[model samples]
Target chain A: DQQVKQNSPSLSVQEGRISILNCDYTNSMFDYFLWYKKYPAEGPTFLISISSIKDKNEDGRFTVFLNKSAKHLSLHIVPSQPGDSAVYFCAASGGYGNKLVFGAGTILRVKS
Target chain B: EPEVTQTPSHQVTQMGQEVILRCVPISNHLYFYWYRQILGQKVEFLVSFYNNEISEKSEIFDDQFSVERPDGSNFTLKIRSTKLEDSAMYFCASTVQSEKLFFGSGTQLSVL
Candidate 1:
């Protein structure tokens, strides 16, 4: 079963606009959530993360908001740039181990 | 900046052949993991290794799959008698007791 899901397969936004990608999880035990950005033929790189206790975390232009009650989280990029065009994956881990459950990923295309 | 490194970026093997994918995690990281993504699918966890042992493994990590950290710096995944469905991009990741993971560029394995 897919514990983490990114409903949107792809998204398109104009450069300089805000781009939002959403994620949902079914397991409430997950305490840590992370986002990773991936380019074609490249490994995923860390973007940002939020703890179960925190509702939001921001790094540079990227922001992640988590809602525990809804079992949902989102990543928002302000002033999206062409370089922001990539697949974004949402991953979560529970209390026990280091195994991370990943979402299907959302492809973001920031058009210039 | 420390980064995970993987060797043999791409490997093409016969269906019944064996293939080994190698990875060198970041120097000081304590936890290591192997994940794979079939083309157009979400990244799926294969196994998590800590202290030279497997902590947890997914169902996909069946009898044919084995992981080893034979040396201080090298971690390898061996697939015995590969199948066509085993073709995917394998990523090795490491973290130092933190929620964020650093992933390698990945080794794309293709079984013909």
Candidate 2:
């Protein structure tokens, strides 16, 4: 149940700064990692994902970096906006199963 | 743009009552899953259904819990006997072939 860990309970960033949210996994077998954003009373929404075969994936203002050796992944949101403020969750799953183990969410507050 | 939808955004039930949470997965997605999160806790996988049968389930999904894709579009989770610990937000997700999932807003089940 503790396979995925997000050590930070919360993170604060300036609107125009880069916000980096990190996640670590104890299970090396996990090959797929995903970042999700959740607002109050809403379910986690998929933001980005990276496969083990690749080290980096980017989508517009968001980029995800994966380190296979260290078993870590991080999400970087550049020029963060106030609308980007939400609880961010990191999830990991591998192989054929769709079962994702999630880390304790980190509340990201982008200050305007 | 197709998104999963859940009914009865909030449900309140007495202890030991039977409560059913409903969800409508994305039209073209072939895999379905159920995950729940307690207040201030990480989301936990409950079960996954495919081909009209359960493909995998977590330990938290005991005999008291059951999932059924009663029709082509609707997936439902039934908890035979609710307990105090069953109060949480239940999310229904679907995917085509990857761990990237489209999740519903969630059903806030309050077991009193």
Candidate 3:
């Protein structure tokens, strides 16, 4: 079963606009959530993360908000740039060793 | 910044042939993992290793697949006899204490 899900397969937005990507999970045991961005033929890069202890985390233009009660999380990029065009994956980990469960990625296209 | 590196960015093998994918995780990272993404699908966890031993593995990691930390710098995944379904991008990731993972560009394995 897919514990993590990214229902939107693709998204398009104009440059300088805010881009929001959403994710949902079924496994309540997951306590740590992360977002990764990937370009074609490249390995995914860590973008942002939030622990179960906090409801939100932000770094520069990127922010992640988690709602444990709803089992949902989202990533928001302010004034999105063309460079931000890539596939975004949401992942979760729990307990020891940090085995991750990932969502089907959302492909973001920031049009200039 | 430290990053995970994988070798032979792409590999093409005939069905039932043995294939070995190699990775070198960032030094000082305590946890190592293997994940794969089939084309147009979600990234799936394969296994996690810590303290030179496997800490956890998914049901997808069967007898045909094996992982080894041959040395301090090398972590390898071996598929004794690859099948067509084994074709996918294999990513190696490392983490320190938290659940944040740094992933390699990945090795695209195509078993014909």
Among incorrect, acceptable, medium and high, the docking class of model 3 is: medium
Ranking by DockQ: 2, 3, 1
Error of 3 at A54 (Å): 1.1
Worst 10 residues of 3 chain A by lDDT: A93-102
Q: How many steric overlaps does candidate 2 have?
A: 0
Candidate 3 TM-score for chain A: 0.97
Could you give the C-alpha RMSD of every candidate to the true structure, in order shown?
Answer: 0.9, 0.9, 1.0
lDDT of each: 0.94, 0.94, 0.94
Q: Which of the two candidates, 2 or 3, achieves a greater lDDT against the reference?
A: 2
TM-score of 1: 0.98
Cand. 2 TM to true fold: 0.98
Clashes of each: 0, 0, 0
Model 1 lDDT tens row, B1-112: 8899998999999999999999999999989999999999999999999999999999999999999999889999999989999999999999888878899999999999
Instruction: Give the chain B TM-score for each candidate.
Output: 0.98, 0.98, 0.98
